[model samples]
Structure formats: C-alpha cells, structure tokens
Target: MVQAALQYERQRRGLGGVFLDEIARIERHVSDAPGLYQLVEAPIRRATLRRFPFGLFYLEELDRIVVLACLDLRRDPQMIGVTVARR
Candidate 1:
C-alpha cells in the first residue's frame, strides 16, 4: 500500500487519499462482519473495493485479521497465483 500510494500520489495529488479511503471502508466492513464475505480459497478471504480494480486478500485468525495483499485485478490470474504462492 505504501508503494501504490506513492505511485498514485505522483500521478495525481489526491488519488492516494481515495485509495486509502477505499481500504478503510473495507476495513470497517470486515470489522463489522468478519465472516460476511465468502472465502476465495482455503485460509484466505477476499472482498472487492466498491469502485477500484483492486481487491484485498486476508486471513482471519482467532485474535486478529491479517491482510495478505492488495491485489491489482488487471494482472493475469496465473501470474498472481504464482506470486502469492511464493509469499
């Protein structure tokens, strides 16, 4: 998110704010209902931002929620799968 925000800020002054706002909004949703969104796969869950092409990947633990990645959906699914597998 830091890198994406930096790039977004360079392109346009306030886009970073928009990007972060979307993330916060999603955070609120997650906080309210941790199991609201269905799991995309075992151990990981996904929720799409309202107007962005990006989506968040996360893991819900007993004590806390761990965000895995902010994915750019424009990328190829196969590439994304491989990239995430490495992590």
Candidate 2:
C-alpha cells in the first residue's frame, strides 16, 4: 500500500501535478470501510480527475486495485478498456 501511494505520487508529479485535495478526497473514499467507490456498480466505471479532462478506470480485486487506465475524455472509453486488456 505504501508503494502504491508512492508510485501514485511520482506518476502524478510527472503528469503535471494532480490537485492534492482531489487526490485526498478520492483516497478517503476509496479507503473507507465499505468504501464510497462501492456505489459505482459497473464492472468498469469512470472517475473524473477533478481539474483535468481525464478519467481513471479501475478494477477492484480481492486485495488490490488495478488502475486500468488514465484516459483522455475525448477518446472512446471502450477503446481504453480494450487497450488495457491487451496490456
């Protein structure tokens, strides 16, 4: 979990910096017991980046989350899924 957070921070910096507050909000929701993210019922779903025209799609696993992709809003999300599946 520590490594994931560190990796997220490093990648976020390289991506021109994510909003700290937004990251905090997401982390809080994601980490909550039973989790706010659980309200999203799709097998795959979109989570908008607070101040960017991008989205993250993740797969929740038994013990870890797989971030499927960070995607441009203008692109087809289905394509992103296909791309991630190939990877």
Go through the candidates in order and give the clash count of each.
0, 0
The digit string of per-residue lDDT tens for model 2 on 1-87 reads 234345556776643334445555554555443233423335654566676565556666678656666566677857766765664
Give the candidate number with the greatest lDDT.
1
lDDT of 1 by residue, 1-85 (tens): 7777777889899988888899899988987777887687778787788867877877789988888788887889777666655
- TM-score of model number 2: 0.51
Report lDDT (Cα) of residue 47, candidate 2.
63
Error of 2 at 9 (Å): 16
In terms of TM-score, the best-performing candidate is 1
**CA shift at 63, candidate 1, in angstroms?**
1.6
Worst 10 residues of 2 by lDDT: 32-41
Alpha-carbon lDDT, every model: 0.80, 0.55
